[model samples]
Structures are given as structure tokens and as C-alpha cells.
Target: MTLLDQPTGPSASVWPPDAHGPRRDPAPLLPDPEPFRMLGTPAADKLDPELLRDLYRRLVLGRRYNQQATTLTKQGRLAVYPASTGQEACQVAAAAVLRETDWLFPSYRDTLAVVSRGVRPVAALTLLRGNAHHGWDPKAHRTAPLCTPLATQAPHAVGLAHAARLRGDDVVALTMVGDGGTSEGDFHEALNFAGVLNAPVVFLVQNNGYAISVPLSKQSAAPTLAHKAVGYGISGRLVDGNDAAAVHSVLTEAVEHARSGRGPVLVEAVTYRLEAHTNADDATRYRTSDEVVAWRQRDPLAVLERHLREHDLIDDAGVAAAAEAAEELAAEMRAEFHSEPELDPMSLFEHVYAEPTPQLREQADLLAAELAAEADPR
Candidate 1:
């Protein structure tokens, strides 16, 4: 039989019966063999000097924000704070890449990203403040509330992107998740839907060494988190998470690709969390001080600052200006957290539904009556 007419497995089609089945070469979707770098490389010269300076300023501010937020938790201001201490590059670049019209769906540890997107510093921590409602208006800023559930925001982002496409709107929804979140079913579903629907969305996974106390080795065996995109027939990109310029470049490309109706892109940023997972986590138990110190040697802020100074993009005055700005923000956060918010217990029933259910209405009435009685005793 001719090569094309060969039969196998009792089938007359071809030697390989599945030869006609649809297949796609995954080479284009695979991540780079090495994490993309920019800071210490010649590529750094290609970035805009002004943009580099701005990124430096933001990184400084983000570091201060993480420090102050963690202090708030110690002072009993916030119920819990998930500090992105060492991952500022990922946070800042994730927001910097998007346009004002785009949406940012952030995880609990991504307060810096939300704040970078123009949300008030204190308001970004509202959910962690134990408030019943989100601190910032999602509709007003095109930012969703800080999601505490792992990977849940991924699906929400995909849904929003798909809906926008159906409405003939050109909007990109970028969502941030940690390495641990990639293991969730929601992550898988989101990638699947985004690929099938060709939705405009970008998934940024900050592979910051550990998912809580679990190291990356335990969370995923995939060569890299970005490689997971290939399974969904999407593009995958890997970057030095601590390199602000590289993260911004990669994410900007992914966002633009999605904006051009090319579907989704998954980017994995290799970073390290310098702090415990949260105020509640004890990282010492699972990790060694040497590991933390080694990562600190490659701190994102320092890395960017080095590049800027080397390129003469920033000077002593510029560094001082950035520090002053960060101090001002920290002061603002401290003042805001020290003051108590005026919360109405009854307002909890307001946003639960368009129309309150009978049970909810009854509870609201009961609470109102109790407050009235307490205000003026009979």
C-alpha cells in the first residue's frame, strides 16, 4: 500500500487512524526557554527614561504601602493584610500596563496593583478591614473588589471579557493570581473559556516562590506556570517578576494582543515574597533565612533603581522625591486607619439584592427598631 493508503488498527484510512484529527503545534505557545530579563541587560536602554523613572517611583511607593499595611495589621487597624513585599514589580507593572478603560481584577495580595490603578490607598484595603462592602466602587473605577478566594477572580475576568465582546465593546480585563491559584479548577476553566471564546483578557501569575507555606515545587510540576497556557491553545510568556521593566513589557504586549482580538495570553512572573504570606502566616517554619536573604539581594526596587541610576534616568534628588512621596502616602494611610468609619448596620441589607427578600427585610426592620430603642429608652 502507498504511504497515504496504509491501513492500521483494522481501519483503511491511514497507518495512523487519527492522522486526520485536528492538531496544533504548541511551539509558538511555549514560554521562553529563559525568563526574559531587562534590568541588567542592554534591553534596559530601549525603555523610555520617563517611564523608567515613573516605574521606580511607583515601586518605592508600593514598598512603603506594603510596609505600612503590615504595620496596620499589627496595630489592629486591618483584620488581615496580605503584603506583597517582594513582588512590587509584578503589582506595579500589572496596573501600569492597562488603559483607564480596562478593568483590573485583583487577588487579596494585590492591593498594590489596585492602588496603582488609581484606587485610594485605604479603600483598596477595605475588604481586609472587615467591612461588609468593598471599599472602592467597582463600577466607578472598573476594578473589582479584592478577591480572597483563590483563582475565583479568573473566571470573573473571563466572563466580563466575553460579555464585553458580545456587546461589541473593546475592553481588556486583566486579572492577577498567585502561583498557588493556578492549581484551582477556576483557573483552568477561565483559560479554557478565554481560548474558546477568544475573549480579551490577560492572566498574570506571580510565581513568588511559595503559595502560602507551600513552595512552587509542591504546587506545580509544570516547567513554568506560563506553560499552562499552551493547554488552552493560548500564548505563554515568562519574565523576571522582579524586573519591573520586563514585566511591564511582557504584560503590555499581552494586553495589546488581547485588544487586537487575538484572544488571551498568560504571563508568569518569577518573583519572591519577602514576607510571610500574610500577617497570619509564619514563613520561618517552612523557609530558611538564607533563601529570603538571597532573594532580597535581587530586590525588585533595588534592581530598578540600579538600572535607572546607571542610565542617569534618576539622581539623588529623584530618589529623595520618591521617598518623600512614599512617606506622604504612608502618613495618609496611618491617619485614615486611626479614624473610625461610620458604618450603618442596616446598610448591610441594601446591596444584597435589587429587592430585599422577606427574611432580609424583616431583619432590617428588627435592627432599625433595636437601634431606635437604644437611642431613646422608653
Candidate 2:
């Protein structure tokens, strides 16, 4: 029996008005008691060998990309980078399950996910490099620009999904956000809209233990970030983000659920970022090295590699091939960043509006005159 079925006394009235309206059983909507895992468990043995090997290859590539991007930041080639050094499983699995027609809405830290979805690595980092508003054409790939603002992309995903539903298009929009972004109004609003509209949307919350330096405990009192779905009336899932097999399985299920018109789903992936929030932040100030060391034992790449090796799904040759491919990608990234990007000063104003406003026109003219003077020098 539910809590509504039990009353204290005659003083207890019909508490929730269940008799007056329809009610949903919240049990089916709640997340698993613990994060769903497959790696390090007997279940890992049954995963497709081919699939596991593919995931391993992508994880290796993603890790190398993270390292190379971080190196660029140190060398002053890239302006800033939010390295997904430890979250390769989440990114690769997410990309693996997405269809070409499906839309991806990613946050700043999800540049790796974008690249995995066919956006060129150099193009994906354009925003981080301060080179362009969007490095690649978002429309061509059905991926939105990597949003830097917290939780803002959630509503965009909801709107697009709802519109697709109305148009009878088979599209599922997946928006990935941090655990901290759960507190934002845009996140809540998107959840509410998705619930009411039954939009084909999935929310992937990569709970990497912190919102910047603030730990998850200090951020919210929810039993788990996945529980955030209950209040919004969508299904919730919890997954071991470090387990490539687990993340891929859970996301695949959730995306299919949404695409099938069951409404949106919320999935919280429990993981950690081995690196600081970014190159600019000091993670050590709030977190201890011991804690980091403990988490490193469950590193996504390492966990997947161990499972693959133990099952004989991948051998020395496979490992060597993956590493060599990663090195080539890293080398290409280094070559790409070697020269300065050719930026047009006036081009910034081009996309602001169809017809430039008077103020915008004035500003563009001023910038143009400045450029002319710089080119001529009297």
C-alpha cells in the first residue's frame, strides 16, 4: 500500500485527492537503489566482444584527445579546456548510441562527445579556442553548439523534441549537463515542459562529484541526482559512468524509451573527473589527492580495458592498434593548433540579425574603420 492509503486517524483527510484525479505510482519512476554497473561484475562477460573492442578504441582516442587538449592549454595554443580525462566512457557510449537523425545538446565539457558524433576535433574546439561561435555546422550533424552556460541547453532540447513530436519526426534529443546544473531554473523548467508535453528528450547528468570545487553533498539534498526525475514525472536511471558497458546499455535503453514516445527520461551517471574543473581552477583546494587516487582506481578507460583483456575480447595487438590510432589523432590535433586561426573581426556581426540594427551597424562600421586603419597605417 502507498502512503496515501494509510491514514493516521479521522483527522486525516483524503490527503492527495487521489479519488478526484489520476495518480502515478512513483516506484516505477525512481532510479535504481545503486548505480547500475556491469564492469567488474559477472555481467560484463556477456557483452558483445566486437562492441567492447569498439568502445575501447573510442575510449583510448577520447582520453588522448583530452590529454592533447589540456597540453594545448599549457602551451597557450588553446584558450581553455574542460578535460574529460576520466569521463571518456560517458562521452563515447553516448555517441555510440545516438542515431544520425537524433539531436545532441551538450554543455561546454561535452566537446569530446561532439567530436565523437562526427564533428571534427579542431572544429569542436573552436569555441574553446575563441576562434568562432561554432566551429562546425550544427545543422549538418544534428548537434547543437556546445553550450557554455549552465543548464540553458535543457530547454532548447525540450522545445526541439516537442516540435519534432508534433511534426511526427522520429527524433530524440539528448542533453547532457553537470550535477550542479540540476539546481538551475532552466533545468527544472525543461523537466516540467518535457513531462507535460511528453517530449522525446533524455537528460544525461554526469555527476562527476562536483560543481566546480563544491562537492555534490553541498549542492543538493536529493537522495540521488536521478531522483530529480520523479518530481517531473519521467523515468529515472542511475548508471556506473566509469563502466563503458554500463553507460552504453543504460543510455541506449533511455534513448529508445524516449524515441518510442514514452516521454523524456533522466539518467544520472555516477563518475569523477580526475582533472581539475578546468586548467584555470585549483581542484586540490577542496578535494584531497587521496580521494582522487581512490577514484583513479576505477578509471573508466582502465576498467573497460581490464574487462576486455580478462575476457580475451582484446589482445596485445588490439591494444597496440588503439594506442597507435590515438597517437595519430593527437599528432593531428597538435598540427592543427600550430598556426593561428584566421579570424575576421567584422564577421562577428554577420549572424546577429538578418538586418543589422542601427547600433549594430554603427559598431560594425567602427570595427571596419579600425581594421582599415590597421591595414594602411597612414
Error of 1 at 82 (Å): 0.5
Cα deviation in Å at residue 13, candidate 1?
Answer: 8.7
| Decoy 1 TM-score against native | 0.91
RMSD of 1: 3.8
lDDT of 2: 0.92
- Candidate 2 lDDT score at position 151: 96
Best by lDDT, which number?
A: 2
How many clashes show up in model 2?
Answer: 0
Clashes of 1: 0
Query: What is the lDDT for 323 in model 1?
Result: 100
Off by over 4 Å in 1: 1-21, 357-378
- By TM-score, the best candidate is 2
The residue-by-residue lDDT of candidate 1 on 207-284, one tens digit each, is 998888888999888999999999999999999999999999999999999999987999999999999998999899
Question: Worst 10-residue stretch by lDDT in candidate 1?
Answer: 8-17
